[model samples]
Target: MDSPFTSKLGTNYCPTAEDAVEIQAFLAQPLRQMECLDRKIAELQHALNKLLEEREGLGSIVQSHEALLSPIRRMPADMMQEIFLACLPTHRNCVMDAREAPLLLGRICSAWRALSLATPRLWASLHIVDRGEPPQRTGCGRCPSMARTGWSVPTIPFAAI
Candidate 1:
């Protein structure tokens, strides 16, 4: 596979017509080999892309099935309600902020929202801060009216408390 041009490479020597013909013949085999390599590389790249797509599809399936086995989804409603109740502040009444529980519990999922709202005890006590603004009486439809005297006077039933 040696070329007559090999010894003459990197020199200013001009090739004769016969030397030029020999150089072209010498290059043919390597050029065909390079073309074969390029085709193989393209085929391997297509196979790699297909494998990556299959892996991504399998990952999505695994994630969805994993959600079905979550412990929270299996817990009984009564137990979940107790956990929600425990999240309430013991030192003081629950605040209207979403950062705290009761309100935070309602934001978790639809089932929890229904349970938290259905549980009247969770909305039993609310510490209202009068920031010189009129109070908004928007709680579980059972929220008593706020007296218009700039004071939050909740007349919640004793049973709800």
Candidate 2:
């Protein structure tokens, strides 16, 4: 029962060989336990890595299924066509601007583009203005904020007219 710290005047008593042997045995048990714990930690780390890989694989599968679940993909072609027709801009004159409604619809996706092009009604609405005609001065959208946002109405090219 000797304390860890001792004064210089304290007895420097040494234990017997039997006592030393018992202490060594006591320390060996804990050493073996520590080795067992280390093995378990390694096994758990490997298991965690495997679980993460499994989760990633499942996530990709889920994402693909979710893409298929999209409402737009499920819409009937006739209904979708009606919706596309409904999206046409009402105020446009006979100008051919790419950023305009009918043209912009084609830029969306291959499905919408095919639908837009196939639907003669959408193209038939185009009103061609003469190149000599002046543009609407009121709609210049020359406000500093509008110009900064790059949202100004795109003008139809004179050559395309």
Candidate 3:
């Protein structure tokens, strides 16, 4: 672009009315171009945000579908039962805490909960820490059959000590 002013632009230079008008006109084109570019950038940023949200939704669906194909989900009920039994403490009876095997196993999923509840051996032994409130019924609530009929594995034996 050619200079609109005849003299070189410096700190000491003072603009006349003509020079001021010319300066405004010279800056107008570039300023409008900058405003147009800003609008375009905002539109692109909005589009990018929408695309990112769609990607997140698709990713969540993929993860949930993948969980259905897990190897543990395919294992036979008997094998899962043995795995649950193995998770029990050998030295002492299982506690009521949700962190340990018997309680934790049931909390895993609906299939595991059904398996754990059906397998009486998992509820065979329990260490009840009485807080010195009146004793409730002495039966395993997890397995209603065991609680009512007292049907459990003879080898493991039920204990509430």
Which candidate gets the maximum TM-score versus the true structure? 3
TM-score of candidate 3 versus the correct structure, residues matched by position: 0.68
RMSD, every candidate, angstroms: 7.9, 12.1, 5.4
Window of ten residues with lowest summed lDDT in model 3: 141-150
Q: Compare the candidates by lDDT and give the number of the best one.
A: 3
Q: Model 1 over residues 4-90: C-alpha lDDT tens digits?
A: 677898999999999889888889999999999999999999999999999999999999999999999999988887888899888
For residues 16-126, write the lDDT of model 2, one tens digit per residue: 797667667667767899999999999999999999999999999999999889999888888876876777766663344668666777898888887766665555444
Instruction: Give per-residue lDDT, candidate 2, residue 17.
Output: 93
- As for model 3, its CA RMSD to the true structure in angstroms is 5.4
Off by over 4 Å in 1: 1-39, 134-161
* Candidate 1 TM-score, C-alpha based: 0.59
In model 1, the clashing pairs are none
Q: Estimate each model's TM-score.
A: 0.59, 0.42, 0.68
Question: Which residue segments of model 3 deviate by more than 4 Å?
Answer: 1-31, 136-150, 153-161
* Number of backbone collisions per candidate: 0, 2, 0
